[model samples]
Target: MKSVHMDVHALLDAGVIERRAAGFILPYDAVHVDFFLKAG
Candidate 1:
């Protein structure tokens, strides 16, 4: 099995996410996403 710690550490260093007492978070209060779907 592959260990994800290395990758997780990279993300942590990049400020893309933050760590909490319980776990990691995306560091944003809220996220807004837009989806475009092409209906056939």
Candidate 2:
């Protein structure tokens, strides 16, 4: 779980996610999300 959190933080650092008051959000659009998923 710590590693997962670290990865999320890394994503935040990379501007791949937006950290909100309550949670985080993947800022990519759905098409990019799909591409990212497949690319990953």
Off by over 4 Å in 2: 31-40
lDDT tens per residue, model 2, 13-38: 98988998889987667525343345
Please, what is the TM-score per model? Answer: 0.57, 0.61
How many Å off is the CA of 27 in candidate 2?
A: 1.4
Clashes per candidate, residues 3 or more apart or on different chains: 0, 0
Determine which window of 10 residues in candidate 2 has minimal summed lDDT.
31-40
Worst 10 residues of 1 by lDDT: 1-10
lDDT for 18 (candidate 2): 93
lDDT of 2: 0.81
